[model samples]
Target: MSPVTYADIEAASQRLAGVANRTPVITSRTVNELTKAQVFFKCENFQRTGSFKFRGAYNALAQLSDRQKQQGVLTYSSGNHAQAIALSGKLLGIATTIVMPQDAPAVKLAATRGYGAQVILYDRATTTREKLAQQLASDRQLTIIPPYDHPQIIAGQGTAAKELLEEVPQLDLLLVCCGGGGLLSGCAIATKSQPNQTNSPSHHPRVIGVEPEQADDAKRSFYTKKLQTIHNPDTIADGARTPSLGKYTFPLVLHYVDDMLTVSEAAILRTMFFLWERLKIVVEPTGALAASALLEGLITIPDTKIGIIISGGNVDLQQISQLLK
Candidate 1:
C-alpha cells in the first residue's frame, strides 16, 4: 500500500480549501491539433508562489504543532520550494530559513527572499545544502521541512492531481515532472486509487514521470528498482536537478508510477517557449518537463485524454532568451 492514499489527498484538499489557488485546467486548440489528442494542462504555473510547491509547503506548515510552529522551519531547495516555504511560513506566522544553491535562478532566489525568509546561498560543488540545513536546524532547534520527503508534504503535493482528476476524471495517461519525486509520488498515489474503499486498477490512468535527460536519476531508478543518484547535472530544469528520490518518495514512486521518460534540454527549451508563445503563459524549464515529453514526441499516447502537470511558472527572464540562442 502507498504511504499516501487518496483519502490523505482529500484531507489536504480540505486543509487547502481557501488557502491554495484552484489553478486552471487549460486546453489548447493548437496543442490538440498538433498532438491529435485531447490534452488538459493543469496550470499550476499560476498557483500561489507560481508553482505546485505551494500546495505541499502550505499543507506541511499548517499541520505543524504549536511548538514546531514557534520554533520555525528550515529547508533547502533549488528554487520553487524555497519560495513556497518562505511564503507559507510568512502566511502561517512562522519564521523560515532557506539554503539555496548559489547558482539557483536569479528570479527564484529573489522571490524566496522577497517572501521574507532568510536566504543562505551555498556552492553545490563544494558542499550540499542538506548538510548546511541540518547544521542550522540542529543549532536553532528549527523543524526541518524537507522539500519532498515527509508524509504531509507528499500528501499535500498529491492535491494537484486530486483537483485535476476532479475536473476531468477519465484520463488515459497522466504525466508529472519528477525531481525528488515529491510531486510525482504524491500524485501517483492519488491517480492509482479511487476515493472509496474498493481499489480498482482498471480505471486508474497510467502515471508516468518525466525528467530531464541530463538529470535522469528518477528514470534510471524506476527500471532498476534500486535507489539511484546523480551528481550536479547541468540542465536548464533547475527544479528537477535533485540528486535522487527521497526515502518516502522512492518507495511510493516505485510502487505507484507506471513508467519514467526523459527529454532533452533542447526539447525542454523548445516546449517552454512554445507554451509561452502559444498558451501565453510563462512556464519555467522544470514546469515544461512533462509537456515536452508529449509535445516533443519523446513519448506518444495517441488519441487519448492526457493530463500534464505544468509544475511552475517562475521564469528567469535573464536566462530565457539567452538559453534559446
Candidate 2:
C-alpha cells in the first residue's frame, strides 16, 4: 500500500479549506501549571459535526468520481465518523449508509440519523461492522469510505495537525488520541513532513499516540513491531475500542510516530471531567485520551512546549449523568 505523504495532506488541506472548521488551539494556565508544560490543545472537539472526522469524511466524499458520487457512499463507525459521513454526504447531495454498533452513544446515533443517512445497527459483540459494510456496499453498489483506513481519509485527518503546526510552529511534542492509528498517523505525517517556522532544525516535535489501557492495540503494535488486535475491549472510550489498526494506518504509525502510550480508565474519566470543568469544553472520553495521559503524568517529558489533539466533543448527556453518578 502506498503511504500517505505531506503533499497528500497539503492537498487535503486545500480541499478542506472553507469547509472544515480550523478549530482553535486552546490553553489554560491551570492545565499548564499542573503539567508543568506549555500546553497547546488543538481542540477538534469544536470541529464541524463536533469532531475531526468531518475533515476526512468531507474530503473523501468530495473526491469521489461523479459516477461513484451518484451511486453514494457506505461506511462503518462507532459514532463520530458515522455522523461525519452522513453530514458530508448531505452537504454534497449524495446518499450515505452507516453501519454502527447498536450500543453506540445515543447522541451520536441521533445526530447521524439527523444528518439524513440510512443507519444500520449491528451487534458489536456478535457481528463485525467491516464485513457487514463491505457486503452492503457490494449489494448496493455504494463506494466504501472507511473511517480511518483510506489514504484520502488519512490525508484529510492530517489537516488538523497541519493547521495546528501552522499556528504553533515551536511545539516540542505533540500527543494525539489514537483509534486504529488514523488521526495519530495523519498528524505524524503532517508534522514530520513540514519544516517548523521557528528556524530551529531540532524543533521538530516528537509525536506520541495515546490510547485507552483496555484498547491498547496501537501501543502493542508499536512495541511488537507488528500489527496487534484486541477483541471488543470493554471500555468507556467507545471510539477507541477498535479491534485493531488498519493496514494503511499501521505502517504510517510505525514509520512516523515516535511512541504510543496507554492511560487508565480512571484517568480518562478524570480528564474528561477536567476538560469540562477547567477548560470549559465538553470532551468525550475517547477525545480526552491524549490529555488524560498528560494530565496524569504518564508522559515523562516535562517543561516543554506540547500540543495535544482533543479529538471530539460528542457525548450522550444522559450517559454522562449516569457515569458521574
Candidate 3:
C-alpha cells in the first residue's frame, strides 16, 4: 500500500467522525518555563480507550468488509493496541483476539480482556508474538490488524496530526512518541503534505520521532537506511518495545520523518512525573517519551512552537511508585 496521504487522513477523519474523540489541545505554563518553548500537548491520554490507539483501531476495523469483520481479527501488542483493537472490535460486533507478552502490564491485559478479546499471554523473552498471532490467525481464519504497520492504521493515526495542525497552525516542530512508527509516520505524512507549512518559519513543523534509548528501532532504522530490528529490548516504555520497524511504516519514516532520537529511561520517568505533578496528566512512560526527549536535550528547536503527542496513559499500577519516586 502507498504511504498514507492527506486524502487518506481526510477520509479517515470521516470514517472516524463522531466515533473518535477530538481530544483537547492542552498548553502547560510550567512546561513552557522549563522547555523555554511554547508547547501544545495533544492529549491523547484522554482519548477513547485512553490512548491514540483507538483512532487507528476504530478506523481500520471500520474499513473491514462485513465478511472479514465476521471472521474476526487478531493482533499482537504489548498493551495499548491490544486494548484499542479489542474495544474497537467489540464496538463493531467483531470477535477480537490479542497475543501479548506475559509480562504486559496487568491493567492493560485486564482492559484487553474486559473488552471481550481473548487474551493469549506468552513469554516475552522466549516466544515471538508475531509468530503466535500468525498461527492463531491461520488456525482461526481471522483477519490480522498489525499495530503500526498497515496503510489503514497509519492513515487513521494521521488524523491526530491533521486535527492538531488545523488547530495549532503555528507549530514549528512535532515531537511524537514512537513505538512501531505508525503514529509518527502518520503525523509526518500529514505535516509534510502542506508544502506551505514545512520549512516555513511561521507554520512549518519539523517532525521528530522519539524512542526509548533501550528500544530505538526507528533510530537504528534511520541510521542504517534499512529497516532495522532490535533483538532484546528492555525499557520501561513497553509501548515502544516493538522489535522491528514494519515494512509499510519504515519507508514512510525514512522519507517523511525529519529525525529520530532516543531518550533515557531516567528522563522518561522524570518527565512522566513532571506531567503528572504539573499538567495533571497521568501519562505512561511511553507517553512521556516526547517530553523526555525535549527535557534531556535529545531534541531541540529554539524559539518555536512545539506540539507533543502524549501517546497514552495506561500505566501499570505497580510501576507507579517507582516511576514517580
Candidate 4:
C-alpha cells in the first residue's frame, strides 16, 4: 500500500478544518479565452504563510506527540516550507528551529523569523541544509519534520488538490508545480484516485508535474524511473530548485502522475508577470511553472477543463526590481 492514500487526505482535511485555508478555485476569462479551454487556477498564493506549504506543515505539527511537542521541532527549507513550519509551530505553541539557505528570498526569510522561529542561515555551497538540520535535531533533541517526505506532510498537502477537484469538476488535465514532489505527488494521488466525476473516457485527469528546465531532476527521474539530483540551478524559480524527489514522494509520483514537463526561465517570468498584470494575482516564478507550460504552448489540449495549481505568491520585490533593471 502507498504510504499515503486518498482516505488519509480526507482525514487530514477534517483535522485541518478551521486551520488550513480552502484557498480559491479561480477562473480567468482572459486565460480561458487565450487557451481556448476552461482553466481553473487553484490559487494557493492566498494560503496561510502565502503558500500551500502551510497545509502540510500545520497538519504534521498538529500530530506531534505530547512529548515531541514539548521538545520542539527542526526543519530545513529554502523558503515556503520554512515559513510554513515557523507559522505552524507558532500556532501550535511548539518551538521551531529552521535551517535555511543564506540566499533564500529576503521576504521569506523575514517572514519565517516573524513567526517566532529561530532561523539559522547556512551557505549552500559550504554545507547541505539536510546535514545541518540533522545535527541540530540531534543536539537539540528536537523532532525533525522534513519539508515534504513524511506521510503526514504528504497527506496534508493532498488536501489542496482535494479541495480544488471538489470545486472544479471533470478536469481533463491537472498541472502542478514540482519541487520535492510533496505537492505534486500528494495532489496526484488525490486526483488520480478520484472516481470519474464526468462521463469522460479516462478514469481521472492526467496529472502532470511542471518543473523549471534548470532543475529538471524530477523530469529526468520520471522518465528514467531513477532518482536524480541537481545542484544550485540558476533560475528565477527558487521554490522549484529542490535537488530531487523524496523517497516517499518519488514512488508516489511515479505511480500516480501521468507525466512531467519542464519550462524555461523566460516562460516562468513571462507567466508570472502576465498573471500579475492580467489576472491581478501575485505569483512567484515557482507559482507560475505549471501555468507557463500551458500558456507557452508546451502542451495543447483544447476544449478541456484544465486545473492549474498556483503554488505560492511569496516573492522578493527587491529581487524583482533588480531583475527589471
Worst 10 residues of 2 by lDDT: 195-204
Model 4 TM: 0.98
- Model 4, 1-325: lDDT tens per residue? 8899989898889999998888988899999988999999999999999999999999999999999999999999989999999999999999999999999999999999999999999998989888889999999999999999899999999998899988886788999999999999999988977654654547589999999999999999999999999987678999887888999999999999999999998889899999999989999999999999999999888899999999999999999999888
- Cα lDDT tens digits for candidate 2, 1-325: 4579989999999999998988999999998888788999999999999999999999899999999999999999999999999999999999999999998999999999999999999998799888999899999999999999899999999999999999988788999999888898999999887865444545578999999999999999999988999999889998898889999999899988999999998999999999999999999999999999899988857678999999999988888798888
263: Cα error in model 1, Å: 0.2
Cα displacement (angstroms), candidate 1, residue 124, comes to 0.8
Across residues 142-228, which tens digit of lDDT does each residue of candidate 1 receive? 999999988899999999998898898889899999999999999898888646313578778899999999999998999999999
Worst 10 residues of 3 by lDDT: 194-203
Tell me the lDDT of model 3 at 80: 93
lDDT of 3 by residue, 1-325 (tens): 4667889988999999898999999998877877788999998998988899999999999999999999999999988999999999999999999998888999999899999999989997788888888999999999999999999999999989888988988788999989889999998898888544656433557899999999988899998898888875899999899887888888999988988999888889888988999889899999999888887776656678999999999989797775556
lDDT of 1 at 237: 95
Pairs clashing in candidate 3? 197-204
* TM-scores vs. true structure, each candidate: 0.97, 0.97, 0.95, 0.98
Residue pairs in candidate 4 whose N, alpha carbon or C atoms collide under 3 angstroms:
none
Mark the 10 consecutive residues where model 4 has the least summed lDDT.
194-203
